[model samples]
Target: MRYALMTLIAVSLAGCTRAPAPVADVVAVVSASLPSDPADAAWNAAPEHVAKLLLQDLVEPRLQAVSTPDVRVRAFTAGQEIALRLEWPDATINDLPAAGRFNDACAVQVPLKPAAAVPDPQMGMAGNGVAISFWRADWQATVKGRGDTIREIYPNALIDHYPFDAPSLEKGSAAQQKMATEYAPAEGAGNRRGGARTTAVEDLIAEGPGTLHPAPAAISRGSGVRTPTGWAVVITRPLPDGLSPTSPSQIAFAVWEGSKQESGARKMRTGWIPISIREDQP
Candidate 1:
């Protein structure tokens, strides 16, 4: 059933022709951070794209209420790396789970090929693939405050004996992390037992719906923070080696607000937007 629904989504997104972003609206990425201190200056100073996203109910796994309506994107490029900062407003803060539910999230999607007709915005279509960098609010909370831990997520849960934290061992916190690696190497470097994760951001690629998978060790990284109004996220990647110097590339965006039960194919998303090198922009 899941596979069938995913196929439907890919076909639907493919049939819907998205308008290409105009040249005037192309985001200009600069050579360096505008301010000396990244924190001292508001990151919104960069070229902006205000996207009006729509609910993802056109396919399967639909949702309601939790859709974030507006997404503000600011972008900049410094030397080899390009960064995008995304912002959206939501009244409820949904970083933690209630019952068995999940937390809020967002992502930035860009096509792997530079000059081709942009891939289907709802993941991708057929052989054309899109690479995505995801940011989850729950992971951000874990990285901050007390660090990622199972106890943190499930406050009342009890543990008999955690192997990572043997009282007799002098290594203390580091011991458990090593034990975690030994136990679940796929879990990566971390002391927390399933609270959040080592990295709040994840890199994934999709050739079509239901085909989302880990990217090929690509160089992409990012971070995010939540506020009373909404979320602020930043994603960075190196400029592709063979990108055409004259043509504008494509990028897309999506948001998943967990508080309103947005998950899977349920969330708000946008189609392709144009992006170009700062030096080339007229």
Candidate 2:
């Protein structure tokens, strides 16, 4: 009995000595200067650190888990702006938008209030809403040309004459504006009041799972570049006022793989992750 007790104690001690898993450090390094447009070189020059994140499949509405499970994130801040760089491996680039087709996309979610309690990572909760800045591959195409135009997507197709493109400039503008509203209702009725614009990313705010609403694009902006193996995306916005250098904040992320036909409730996502703002480096 004495020997058995001694062995048990030794085993317990061994178990206690096991080291915990290493925690990933994610910080938004402060910079004296940051470019308005984040090019590859700009991100490379900025002091950055990466965090490894694992995303679980959200299978409530449907089974949508085609995206890669691994995600890497880096970030930096300069002046009043903060930029987050997210990269993940994807075997294919799915930007084509057609019947039953979807686009590859990624999003970054941040709480509206700097110190607010963590809301639902899916979006947010009631008054604890989070700002979601979503970047889609299909949308990026529009930034370069008239992506929605039939001629742009389908060059081989024969000439298409629309009644809207009449000889009269005023009449043509009006017709096009009217068509824009019918095509994109989410853009609201205000788009008709002005000339059309090529929208890039989607800016939204959600209080809960189904409370997502379009937010002003002026709040957040993002850009992305596709690589051979995957995608590298940058999401940038002005820092929230009253945020202190050492204040601890939280950010969450989600990804959609169009090649896997992932959409809606079906995707891979991570819960809120703690982040801090570091003092600016000279």
Candidate 3:
């Protein structure tokens, strides 16, 4: 059935000269920078080519585990090509087998909502050299099928690398950091709104043990990166049962440093989704 569905989609899409694509919702912290043309407009509206590129390059490979998809990706875009984000919802993990953390490790009861994950800058035949932030927080978790061999071999199991990134730092261990780096962004450090305009910002790529980060990212002081000061995310995990003042379900986020050992590094103060986030036809 899954193969047939993908086949059907491929055939259907193949027959079309032009297909609707995914659109990215651009939320500008500084107004007046938003794209104006229909061709350039961010989320809720975008060209088909953008969506097609994402499906071909990123989405498809990540979606092999999905048995059925309710929402189809529509488009993608960014002033800063460095960080490209694709928007869509995935609830399939809720259907995976669960046997309470042994071998047949089932996913947490929480369903995955519409979310985006960062595609590797190295994905293309030519790697895009820059730091790309896909799901700034919660959505960063890795998703995929464990396959029959792995599942059969380890029935009452904890699917290795099961929960992607946790909202709390304490929840993710050194092992998780090593595994999460498999999906973490390239260690470029700093958001490039475009080729130019490198706002001075303090950023860190936390990895394992002491503020786990991947590669060491160098930022010149006069380079003008946005200076978001003093943060040290130790790890990423979901909000503990009740901790955040804002919606407790929010994804943890940071551009600089990481959660620290000081206190509450493992807690989410708010939920992640915002009104400007995009939604596709489901």
Candidate 3 regions off by >4 Å? 1-32, 35-42, 49-85, 92-131, 136-282
Q: Superposing all C-alpha atoms, what RMSD in Å does each candidate have to the true structure? A: 13.5, 10.9, 20.7
Please report, as a residue range, the 10-residue window in candidate 1 with the lowest summed lDDT.
33-42
For model 1, how does the per-residue alpha-carbon lDDT over 1-282 read when each residue is reduced to its tens digit? Answer: 999999999999998755324333437556555332223244544655788787775566766654688688776677767777777987777777557676788888888675447778888877788888877777777666655556666888788876666776556467656675676665664333245455677778898878888777747666776655777777777664334336568778888877678876888998877677665322
What does the lDDT read for residue 134 in candidate 3?
Answer: 19
**In model 1, which runs have C-alpha deviations exceeding 4 angstroms?**
1-26, 34-42, 64-66, 97-99, 162-196, 240-245, 280-282
What pairs collide in candidate 1?
164-176
Q: Mind sharing the TM-score for model 1?
A: 0.74
**How much is 139 displaced in model 1, in angstroms?**
1.5
TM-score of each: 0.74, 0.76, 0.22
- Among these predicted structures, which one has the highest TM-score? 2
Best by lDDT: 1
* Model 2, span 1-282: residue lDDT tens: 999999999999987634223236456778776544534665554444344444443335754333567567767788778888778888887876777878888888888775435777777888888888888877776665534665555678786565445455355476676764565665555532112335556778888876777785657777777777788888887775434476767778888888888766666777877767778532
lDDT of 3: 0.25
